[model samples]
Target: MKVAVVGGGPAGYVAAIRAAQLGAKVTLVEEGELGGECTNWACIPSKTLLRAVEVYKEAAEYLQDLPKFDWKAVQSRRWAVVKRLREGIEKLLSMNEVEVVKARAQPAPGRAVKADGRVIEADALILATGSVPAPLPNLPFGGKVLDTKSALLLEEPPSSVLIVGGGAAGAELATLFAKVGSKVVLVEVVDRLLPALDADIGRTVERELRAMGVEVYTSSTVLSVDDRGRAVSARLKTAKGEIDLEADYVVVAAGRRPNPGPFADLVKTDERGHVVVDGQMRASAGWVYAAGDVAGPPYFAHKAYAQAKIAAEAALGRKAYYEPLAVPAVVFSDPEVASVGMTEDEARRAGYDAKSARVPLSISGMGLISGGAGFVKLVYDGNSGRILGVHAVGRRVSEIAGEAALLVEFGATVEDLALVMHPHPTISELLVEAAELAVGKPTHIAKRGP
Candidate 1:
């Protein structure tokens, strides 16, 4: 069988490699870089800068005198990391014997694609064109206004930045600039930050950002931006009243827009333009598939890998399907946040009779030693005693999300988690403690009736 995959991003590349491994001839086409936004600009570069800022922040706490950060050096290292990872993906594709074509590929009639002024036909086609930062209305990109992608390519940090949106991307960028001595004001239109996660988690992250000197304005929107050569004056409408916010630059991290490219007619799409796929990652058309950011929300590269594998296998006449019980969502902010499965409210809304318990990281020896303040929340079904979700926030909590995902996947109960012995003086122990509290047998913290 011959397979043609469009967009050599996390989804398309993985699909190409997987199909090739299944003894199918694969051809991968990408308009730009192989790793897409996740590699070239979004995830890798942003996190690289975040890590550097995190290190500096941590050191500043202990040492009275810390050396000033060199933005150029950090940018150089960011490029190096991205280049190395991109090369690794290229080598992987080469080893898998997948033919890669670099061009803007458009879907041609009848299972064929048009790229580089030629038509190539395949038995099956996979669309994984990924996404771009959604443009903010009225305030267009360029000059002093920047989107997330353009913000990443900045040669130097701006003197002052007004970030419009308080999601993961906005929060991360706010943290980055504020830590590097750039005055930052993060404005969110919603009542809180990270509206996708639990309300408490958002509140916790907001507190952490404030402690780092980031001015957060929730329930606010950027009305207009006036670029006057020297500075940009933004008119912001808040719940209270309207005010002018001046900054060296205005960054819009409003979210992302799906890019199915010229193949939009081949698949069903949601109102937000995301491609809709079935359980097996199959599109409306039988011979076509879609994955990654183009497929839908909770957009993570790891999720794309799973979808890619399923789409590839199914395309190869295999019995593979993508039906995951829980997909972890992680926000790598100062006090990192991670969650899997439903939130307490979500479980209750789903008619699960949900009960929740929270154990503050302060109670754990590791959390206290690490000098971070956050908590672990465990949501479970009261009737069935099945774990519904795990939400964590604090230092290194992102690493604990894997175990939390496993529990949610296996439908592990409070007792099941409490019975597992976690090592002493570690953040992992907080999971056990939270479970104990949920089951009405508190270990480290005082028991509260759930």
Candidate 2:
């Protein structure tokens, strides 16, 4: 089958690679760079800048204890880190023997695609056109008013920034700027930051942001942003009253919107313009499909990868389906934030009769060794005693999400976790303790009742 993937993002790129591996004739079309937003704009660049802030923040914050590194030296290294990775992605697709077409694609099902005034036919068309930052209805984007995509491209850190939105990107960037010694004020319209995480987890994350000297205001709205050439004036509505914020730069990490507005009739999309896919990552029509951020909820790279594989395989006449038991959500902050499966609220809302256990990693040997504030939370079905959700926040806990994620995938109970032996003084050890604590026989249980 001749497969053409639209969009050069994680979903599209992975689908192309997977289709090629499956012995299909695959050609990928991308409008901008090869790696899509995740590689070029969204994920990779944000983390690269965040890493710079991590080093800079730690040295300055822990000057007496930790060895110092020159801030200018670290700042100088960021361009090299991001540029090389972007170039490396371009090389990888070429190495895989997949034809990389650099153009914006207009897809016609089971027919051909038009890009850059050229036409190409394919047996299967994968639409991974990805997303762009959602616009604030009252405010426009320009001047000192920037989005997360533009924020990463910045060479010098802003003296002060007002970040709108409290999702992963907003929260992460706010913390990053604060760590880099920028005065960052983050405003979320919701009741809490990281609304995707459990309320408790969100609370903990908020505490961490405040500790970093970030001005976090929940239940707030950015009424308008007026650019003043060098800076911007933001009219915000806080819980207490309306307030005006002075910002050298205004970063909007609000949300994202799916592309291809005209294709909604040909495909499935939710009310908010995100593509809707079935269990097999297929649309209402058998051949039409969607994945990645465009596909709606739990928009993460790993989820996109899994969805792409299923979408591509099924498209190629395979019997594959993409119903992930656990889709890990990882936010790479200083101490990181990782979550899988349901939140406590989600469990209760679903009528699972669930109970939860929360354990601060500070009590764990690994937390002490890492010299960071870390914590883990496990939510379980009270009747089935199966693992429902796992949340961790700490240094390197993002990497350790797999350990707890597997338990979620396996429908494992606290008992199931007891059998596995985690290495001592490691981040993963906290997951086991959290699971054990949920069952009331934990070695490091914090409390008796949930």
- Which residue pairs in model 1 clash with each other? none
Per-residue lDDT over 1-450 for candidate 2, one digit per residue giving the tens place of the 0 to 100 score: 888788778898889888888888888888788777787677876787777667665566556665444445554565566578768767777777888888777755456778777787877777787777877777567788888888866777778999989889988888777876789999999999888787776787888889888998999998888888888888999999999989999887888787744456767678888777777777765666677888886667887888899989988988998877888888886568989989878999999987887888887887876656868888999898899999888877888778668889989997788678989988888877877777677887556655
- For candidate 2, give the lDDT of residue 311: 84
Q: After superposing candidate 2, which stretches have Cα over 4 Å from the reference?
A: 61-76, 108-110, 261-265, 284-286, 445-450
Instruction: Tell me the alpha-carbon RMSD of every candidate.
Output: 1.4, 2.6
Each model's lDDT comes to 0.90, 0.80
* Best candidate, TM-score: 1
The runs of at least 3 residues in candidate 1 whose Cα sits more than 4 Å from the true structure, single-residue gaps closed, are none
TM-score of each: 0.97, 0.92
Q: Candidate 2: TM-score?
A: 0.92
